[model samples]
Target: MSSQFTVEKTQHPKTKPDQQNLGFGKHFTDHMFLMNYTAGEGWHDARIVPYAPLSLDPAAMVFHYGQAVFEGLKAYKTEGGRVLLFRPDQNLERLNISNERLSIPQIDEALVLEGIKELVRTDADWIPTAEGTSLYIRPFIIATDAALGVHPSPQYLLIVILSPVGAYYPEGLKPVKINVESEYVRAVRGGTGVAKTAGNYAASLRAQEEAEKQGYAQVLWLDGVEKKYIEEVGSMNVFFKINGEVVTPALNGSILSGVTRRSIIQILQDKEIPVVERRISIEELYEASVNGTLEEAFGTGTAAVISPIGELNWEDKQITINKGEIGQVSQELYDTLTGIQNGKVKDTFGWTFEV
Candidate 1:
């Protein structure tokens, strides 16, 4: 792995958008980081080039076999004029986990991190300093072998693009309604459930569409084997505060180990709050709601950070959590996590990496 990167500035720079109206992932930065991998030659040709469309053969393996993986993180501009990245190492490590699962070549984590830092530094002006805006970083890899085969491609392209995105939800921290999906299963154990591959999200589209039709923000998935145990939410990990304890479904090889989820758990434990990870069943959750013990429910991930789940619609039996408002725990966690990311609060865990 080489530490050198060729730089190419865009000849025609586009006008920057208003930070106030920057929606999620709608606008891209001027440049992107790119690299290539060959089966025998390893990863090479690392460079920072102008953002542009890719030209791939019609028979590209990624188009046919779906041998692709991606990871998302964000870079924040602090109030004091410092730029920070939140736990990028964890995301890259998870990317390699996905690569191993998909039979793709392992990436040089340190080298990739360097590339990301350089790219972010180059595009530092694009980092929005608005109330809830930051530069979203998307790193992805796709099989590029131009063959109609159902196997891993011998060649791969790795790219990292930046987007100045606003709050993932239009309502900000306001609670959202989620549908408990029963008809569709997102992933199964021993499958590609845990891996952050393209297929998992593709498999979730139908259920998500139906949930949207029902006026829900996202769908809560259940275990595929029995369809009784709680799995995760559409794009985040689900958590519940029942009775006096905080509980999230255990990572049973079918749920993504979200970076925000881990940070929340750590923050809870640091505060001496009771937090547990185990196999939580939907029936148990519903029973808790019946007994009036189900207090707060939220989803944690990179995009939304902490999405307060206000209502759970299970087979038309809607249960409003925390009176359909944000709970104390959810609010505190969101504030603390976002504070650390933006350098407003002390990062006791040393999670943020300064660029």
Candidate 2:
């Protein structure tokens, strides 16, 4: 059993029941977990504070230099009314990895995990019990020292906020249209793309908004150098099915190694599906599509577990995948993924951690 963190809950004076229709990141719980860290003292002053605005100096290092890292995971209220986390240790480990890349000090993994559970328990009422709904946990660290110099801060603040989120595909798991980015690059070699840092997403916002303006749901980013290999989407990892085999871009220092992506690969491999983690080029994907070998394509992440890619649109070329609908492999992957997550199936991989 995980050690429990002491919580100081602040009751929301005027709170109402959240509508089930409220989508992801809209509704928040009443209390939040926080801790402060200093270079000399290390991590200390852990507490459960009220869900309120942060007090940061105008000349804070995070404001000027963008020294921030974040993690996204979920707390699920199981059918048995028990709150659980899916591979939270993996998220904690990834968060530290991201912190190292950002020059921030590492945090205690066990303490962070314990604090998250305590926050969720305090805000248990905020966790939606409906299917496909969960409490989205956002744990982040930010440089907090009031300094104008472009150097690492001597102090940092870590926080965990909980939000009740509905299904990514509220209506259904329909296919999404993706625009192949030719001009913009999300991450380059030796860049911070592999880490879950805010700068990466901040860099991709322009392309994402442009994609939305152009009538596409998301932009599929390619390698920065050659612009031929598929890296990832704005917020999810990409996967392609070619010749009845599962293929995803390997961790090549330019793409995030998503937890969902790893889980899907493990699930498929366990079921005797040929899973390959290699560099998949855009031209090869197009060729496979034209030859009827590219059976399906999808994006995987924590928010959107598995979203099908119906069509890929590039410069003056449009390729339809799986007849512009969700394929067998995509559906199976989604079902298995969600099933294991919601406790509807046996956790063969021991992914679930009861909170």
> Best candidate per lDDT, number?
1
The best candidate in terms of TM-score: 1
| lDDT against true structure, model 2 | 0.89
Clashes of each: 0, 0
CA-only RMSD, every prediction: 1.3, 1.4
Q: What tens-digit string does per-residue lDDT give for candidate 2 at 158-202?
A: 999988899899888999999999988999989998899989999
- Deviation in Å, model 2, residue 155 alpha carbon: 0.6
Candidate 2 structure, TM-score to reference: 0.97
Give the least accurate 10-residue stretch of model 1, judged by summed lDDT. 1-10
